[model samples]
Target: MRRFLDKLYLVSGALAAIFTVGVLVAVTMSIVTRQLGVHIGGLNAYAGYSMAAAGFLALAHTFKSGEHIRVTLILSSLPAKGRMRLDLCALVIACIIAGNLCWFSFKLVLDSYAYNDISTSDDATPLWIPQISMAVGTLIFFIAILDETIRRYKGIPETIQSEEAHYE
Candidate 1:
């Protein structure tokens, strides 16, 4: 199960990288088309969608790897026991927030699908197409938070380091 979850994060991260590249490619193509006097409708909107997907899909992997920005100054000052306790508390709060985000994101995807919502852009892209990626990312991020919370509750040491030296 651990391996599976890790693989999921890795895959999500890779997909995000792909989407990020897609954004660059789209913009480049748009520029090339403009240079050639070829009109491409909705290029900007497509690039926007790619950017959204890239950001959303990277969330879980970033969080798991401790790459997300965190204020560790207080944690660093605490004793081992105190730090552990505070970390667990923070994880619990994060889980709650991530859970709420996942629920609403999923609902947004469902509502978009049910309403047959389409973007107002020239491409008329279906909104659910992008919403699905957002919802999946949120769900995985929630899972990652819950996983860390469970590990902490079980007295397992976290991989996140509070020491300044660990930053390098």
Candidate 2:
């Protein structure tokens, strides 16, 4: 299960990178077409979509990597036991927030699909198509937070420092 979860996070991160590249491609194509006196209706919209996807998809991986910002000023000041307790409390709160976000994001996607919502852009893109990424990303992020919460509850040492060290 650990291996599978890790792989899931890795895959999500890779997808985020791909979407980032997609944004670049879309913007570049838009620029080139405009310079050639051709107006592409959807390139800008596509770029915006890709940018959003990249941001959303990167969330779980970033959190897992400990790349998300932390208030170390307070955490670091605490003793080991106190810090662990505080960290656990924080993780629980984060889980609640992430879970709510995941639920709402998925609900939004479903609502958009049900309503046949289309973007007002010239391309008339289906909103659900782009919203799927947000839903999936939020779900993954919630899972990651829950996983951490469980690990902490079980008294498992955090791997964040080691993971960061490995990268360095």
Candidate 3:
């Protein structure tokens, strides 16, 4: 299970990286085409979509990697048991918020699909297509949070922080 989750995070990260590259490629192509006196409709929208995908898809991987911002000063000051309780509380709250986000994001996609919404841009791309990334990313992120909460409940460390070693 650990291996599978790790692979999932890595794969998501890789996809995010690919989308980042897609954004770059889109922008470059747009510029090149414009230089060549060709008008490409919706390059901006394509780039925006790729950028959103990249950001959304990277969420779970970044959180698992201990790269996400955290307010550890208070946690650092607490005793082990106190810290454990506090961490658990924090995780619970995060899980709730993330779960809500995931639910709403999926709902947004469904709503878009039901409405047959399309971008107003010349591309007329379906909005739900782009929204899928946000929904999936939010779901994965919620899973990651729940995973950490379980680990913490089991007395396992939550995230591996190199800063802990660096400080010692």
TM-score of each: 0.95, 0.95, 0.95
lDDT of each: 0.91, 0.93, 0.92
Q: Quick one: ranking by lDDT, best first?
A: 2, 3, 1
Q: Which window of ten consecutive residues has the lowest lDDT sum in model 2?
A: 158-167
| Tens digit of per-residue lDDT, candidate 3, span 1-168 | 988988888899999999999999999999999999999999999999999999989999998998888878898999989988998999999999999999999999999999999999989999999999999989888988899899989888866774576479
lDDT of 1 by residue, 75-154 (tens): 88999999989989999999999999999999999999999999999889889998888899899999999998999999
**Which is the better candidate, 1 or 3, if ranked by lDDT?**
3
Can you tell me which runs of candidate 2 are displaced by over 4 Å?
Answer: 162-168
TM-score of 3: 0.95
**Model 3 weakest 10-residue run by lDDT:** 158-167
Off by over 4 Å in 3: 162-168
Candidate 1 ranges with C-alpha deviation above 4 Å: 160-163
